[model samples]
Target chain A: MREFDLLAHVYRSNVDLPADVAIPPGDDMGAIRLGGQTLLVTVDQLADGVHVDLATASLEQVARKAVTRNLSDVAAMAARPVGAVVAVSLPRDFGDTRATELFDSMRRTAAAFDCPLVGGDIAMWDHPLLISVTVFAEPGEVEPVLRSGAQPGDGIYVTGRLGGSNETLPDHYTHHLDFMPRITLARELAGDAATRPSSMIDLSDGLARDLKHLCDAGNLDADLTIADLPLSDGAHQAARRTNEPAWQHALGDGEDYELLFTAPRSPRIETADVPITRIGTMRPCAGATPAILLHLPDGATCKLADLPSLGWEHHA
Target chain B: MREFDLLAHVYRSNVDLPADVAIPPGDDMGAIRLGGQTLLVTVDQLADGVHVDLATASLEQVARKAVTRNLSDVAAMAARPVGAVVAVSLPRDFGDTRATELFDSMRRTAAAFDCPLVGGDIAMWDHPLLISVTVFAEPGEVEPVLRSGAQPGDGIYVTGRLGGSNETLPDHYTHHLDFMPRITLARELAGDAATRPSSMIDLSDGLARDLKHLCDAGNLDADLTIADLPLSDGAHQAARRTNEPAWQHALGDGEDYELLFTAPRSPRIETADVPITRIGTMRPCAGATPAILLHLPDGATCKLADLPSLGWEHHA
Candidate 1:
């Protein structure tokens, strides 16, 4: 069992808590109320060898990616980034200059997004460096766009193209360049009344897998058209060279950090600056065999239910 | 060089932050602003073997100690506790009941001090179980008590007896009793209107070492009277069995987590339930000499400056 399961078994026995906790434990982030404002708080940890190879990645890049990973969660909640606290466990070998570079990058990133690095902790450990960042955002009650909000008759839209993360893994993973532009664009669209989507989630864990989450949580099914998939040239070329299908790369690859949302059809919404493509439609659950029905470019229709979930799994 | 030193260099070179960060980059905690209120935020990480021995320490006690350590920091500032966030990195072998007990103990202690556990992160780590907690508190304007605030005429006062932590270490290290009450009492006493200590600190690094810190920071010297020292029976017994003086235990034993403050003599302040002992008075800085002067019962004065600083050092 996971540690959370153990925690639930031990502490969750007594369920008495104040009404301020809107979204309690066991979610991507916890939500609470403060003076009519809904606050979203989430934390993410990046270990040296497990999350990044520090020998290859610059401290600046490591710092930016650390904050961006949490920012992606803020985007998931459709919340404006407010502030963050970073706690770091450092190996004794790391010098002062490298540590400073990491903090500088974090401060710049937080400031660039108008979020402040409020507070944190620093300690020495024998283990590889662990950087954990907790981000807090003030998301006023405009209805938190959750995974369970997808509905039948809703059109699926994905912001930005996919599969490029692998071909340009260094740029996507190290520099954190790919996520910034996409997140900025997504946030702009989310803020605009004309382009606001009903339900939105950042596609960090690939299109096919994350779609299954949205569909499963909403108790609906998705019919995705493979022909309408938006694939990056780099991703397509890399997949071709590797003898892997470009569609599979676009469908199953993770860390894209792109927004995937479903909203009712609206013509006034412009997709000029934002490179969003219409991919599919939500439908009532059909058969027990397939919760997500994929309409291939070929005549074949594949069932996504029996497929294994993609992306990173902690235990696996 | 340490990772924190490197972090300081990077952050210093990269960007210009807001003006309110009084004690930024290095120190026990980072201080920031919240709508004109000075908020002190600090995080401390306790790993299984590094900070506590999980083999002997109960998970509940480990969790409580982890939070109490940070609470001691809030007490150091003479600030009231506001809230906290706890992030836990669990080894895969950790059971569910342990996680529950950990969270339950943490939540109870947080509530006991009126500082609720707002949110946190839980992840799986391969080696040791790491628990990091970040605490927040509002700084008092008149006396956001710091180590540097002591004056030459200031009299040093310590709340409660010292050296009892070693005797209670069995119960505390085993998770049989709560340490939050002692911490709360210290914080409450530090902020008491009647006392209004000029400079204050929490005694984690033993009385002699911590007094040296206060004296060094304030550019003054301190003389402690051995006769005025408060000794618990358990500490006295332990010292006697070890063939050592009981006063040494009261003076130099660490992990006391008591409040050590310096204030001018005040008629309004009288004795209360918590034991308050006038141990010493600050004097002019002796050039190239002792920062803390200990007056023993033998009538000979010994300099604490020559002694090695006590308590847990990350590198040591």
Candidate 2:
């Protein structure tokens, strides 16, 4: 079983939650009540071989990815970054130079996102570099958005173009390692009283998988029009290089770090700071066959299961 | 270089701290100002080979150690536990049964300690089990005790006996994995206006190393009497079996998870809920030899540097 599958099999929220736990596992970020205020917290990690190739990727990039990935979760919840604690298990041979580079990058990245490096633990072990970043943040002015809040008939929108984030690093492609979290956009949307997203999640494991998660959490279904998929220029270029369909990269290629949110109504297009697009609509679960329906650019319809899922696949 | 050496080389708190970060690293638990109140946070990890022998220890012990270790940090700060999140990196072959047992144990341990499990992330990698627990807590009614508050004339006291925590597990010999944190004792000491500790730290890396840490943080020295040490029966037994002195085991063995603190004056510890012992006294850094001095029963004294520095040695 893959990581997500393992989690699905084991984790169950609301079973016997303690009084302080406002939210539990299976969300973009968990919320715990603190002095009448809600704090959103999340922990994510980037392993050496599993998440990045240490040989090719700079220590800075690796550290940045570790911080940003958690920030992306914070963004999904539309929370304001407060502080972070990192835990690092390093290879035995890792010395001062590499450690300095990693911490510097981690400190710099956390600062850039307004999340300072408050505390951390580091230990040397006979294993690949494993960095676990725990981010603590204040909920949005109103409440932290959750993946399970999606309602039927909600408009599904995505910030920025998706797919092709898995491009080999140090190249010209949109490296997910350097991709920024859409925190500002999330805050603006979450703060707006009139039109905030009903539910939100960051696209880390690709559109096809993430969208399914949103639907499953809400016990809903989704219908996406292929023609409306926002294809990144990198996805297009890679499609040409690999002789693959652009749609495949746009839908399945993970590491987008983009926000895939659902709102009661289509959010008004305003600032150009970050590109936003409406790609689909949520529907009530009506069939046992598939929770997602795909509309082809050619006006043909098929279930999402018919498509070849790519990107970061958490196998079961 | 070891982990502590690397931390000493790299970590410099207050270098560029965010406005809200009240206490930084090197403390029992870092404090951040949340609203008008202070929130204490800390993260600690237990790796397979480094912290446990998975071959001998049950999954429950492994998970319990992960939670208790962080809880011990919280107890050291005398902070009220609010919640916790765990992140686990497991070997690829780790299956559903082991994962279930681990999470169940984690949930149970956290709940029992009143530090409920709010959230966590789990992943599979080509490595042994590594669990990181991040605990969030509320500062005690008073300011959280700090390691740097010790004074030269402070009385050094420790809760419970020390050493023999490293006895191979599965056999009952003061299992560090199941050791209870001294949260109530710390709260009592910290909340008491008459006899609060000047500085406090948990004995995780043995009394010798941890006492030296308390002295170094407070810019003082310590004089520990070997005769006054409270050696656990298990430690005495292990020492006899290994042909080692009980004092060595009590002073050098780590993972005791006992409270080692210093009070400005000898406090009247009335309640016998937990054993309390006075083993040493803080002193000025008058000698150039060592920050710690061991006073033998025969009236002879020696620097801590002359002793075997056993316990947990972190590699850099």
Candidate 3:
């Protein structure tokens, strides 16, 4: 039998609950009320070989990655993270010192981001170790910036540069390009009541694919100009080393964690601290046709829908 | 390498975060937003062969059990459950229909209890299926009913009967007994403002060991009467069939999900719908010793602390 089948058998019992539940269990994040505010919550599990390969990274790096990945979701909704709950299924060989270091690193990162680590569950698993982080954030009055809010004439923008996370790390622990810059930028932009994006989403699955998500959500088509893409130095270097087009890597590489948003054109918005570049505009959805139109630096344009879908598929 | 070591390696990169994070990830649950009406959030994961065996159980049962086990924690704290979020990791073999069934069961169960399923993360895993449910609750006006609230002269009370779960289900469904009586009597009793228990905790780890948690927390001793213990018909029958004392199972069997609380003897509050039995009285903590006293029917009292510690131990 499947694992879910087992869970269903042992856990699917009815319950008599009180009236305070706003959003119940089984969703991405269960929301409850604190006074008059609504809190959005969600938990994600990252397992070795399942979510990432541990052999290629450091313990502290992994811990930070886990926090960033979940925090990316909080950014997507334009919510300010309040706290988090972490549950770890450790292998028997795990020791206290290593656990402490892992926790300390995560704690520092969380504190740096304003969201505190609230509580967590630790266990010994005979199989692989699993790290599940549940984040709680306050949902603002603007109703989280959803992917479906883009309109036909909305302008599409991306914060920071993208691509090349798969390459080698930086020397002497200086700066890692993979670390998300959008967390601060998105919060800064969205928190300003004057500059809210019509639709906002984190680009974890690559801009090529994520832009499609934004366009598809509103049944709209997105047109992008390759010349406007912001390419990170590391990404450009990696593309050059591999003799590949930097634009393709910027468009197709996942784990960028940048914020991809759509909003009506506004000149009053400040773009100084945040490196936001307008890459495209939204149009009516072409139904059964390409959802994203990409203009090449050489004057040719291609439809993303016409290409083989890539990046990440949960099941694939 | 250990599982957690592997996780630490994969997720420990330095990432930028906000400033308010008091604790970061790595505890049983992370805690943040203290002082201004604290919120307690926790997530528990149930895996096939790990937490439950689902080969012989129904899907609905598995889903229900998954939700309640997490809900039981809220009951333990005497906190009102507000909402929950589910992160489901399913094997590819499990089709969308099966996933839908699991979610549907969860939705219906949450709705039945008044908590609506708001959002969640659904992913595919190569290993056994895993379901992580996170529960969110708010501590009411009264200070959070913590395990440390019991006083030396407080009366220790238990809600409902214990120990028949093992006998209530078919022999093949022994694990099913762990989650019976879906609705916790503790939540109901705590909700009634007039009779709220001073210190409330759910009996997930058997009455014998759990009461010790209360003793350790309150820095006091408990003199419990086994004769005053309430036993279900299934527990009695199971004892008779096994030629053992029924009280043993009642005190030692885990997964009871009943509320164990303490209160001052005044205010004379009674809840007719929920059965509550006074099983013990608290005493000042003895020097260098934290213990529980079991009063036998013969009026002889024995220190239960001398006996082997029973109930669930995650590592074990």
Best by DockQ: 2
Name the 10 consecutive residues with the lowest summed lDDT in model 2 chain A. A307-316
Which candidate leads the pack in lDDT?
Answer: 2
Task: Summarize candidate 1's per-residue lDDT along B212-289 as a digit string, tens digits.
Answer: 767766888898898788886646765866667787777877667777888886413344567777888999887775
Residue A36, model 3, lDDT: 66
DockQ (C-alpha based) per candidate is 0.36, 0.54, 0.31
Those runs of model 3 whose alpha carbons end farther than 4 Å from true positions after fitting are: A1-34, A139-143, A170-178, A237-244, A266-274, A286-290, A311-316, B1-38, B139-144, B164-184, B191-194, B233-244, B266-271, B297-299, B309-316
Clashing pairs in 1: A6-B96, A96-B5, A96-B6, A97-B6, A99-B6, A99-B7, A100-B6, A100-B7, A100-B10, A101-B10
Best by TM-score: 2
| Model 3 CA lDDT for position B85 | 72
Per-residue lDDT value at A128 in model 3: 63
Candidate 2, residue B74: lDDT: 90
**Local distance difference test, per candidate?**
0.68, 0.82, 0.67
Candidate 2 lDDT over residue span A1-316, tens digit each: 5566655544563366666678756788877788877878899878998888788778888999999999999999989888888899988788878887788789888888878787778877899999999999987465788888898889899999876676653455446777889998898888886679998999988888899989988889999988899888768877977888787788887888999999987677587478888999999999873388989888999888876655446421
Residue B59 of model 3 has an lDDT of 75
Once fitted onto the true fold, the runs of candidate 2 whose alpha carbons sit more than 4 angstroms away are: A5-14, A140-142, A169-174, A288-290, A308-312, B8-14, B168-171, B287-290, B308-316
Residues A1-316 of candidate 3 have per-residue lDDT tens digits of 4332443432333244334445433222345666666777756667776666667667787788768778887887777777776767666576777777777777776767777665655566566666778878876544566667778888888877877756674552212323753555566667676678888878766888778777766788888998889987657877888777787778887777778899886414465565778888999877775378889899988877665654434312
Put down candidate 2 lDDT per residue, B24-84, tens digits, no spaces.
Answer: 6668887777776687899988899888889877888888899999999998998889888
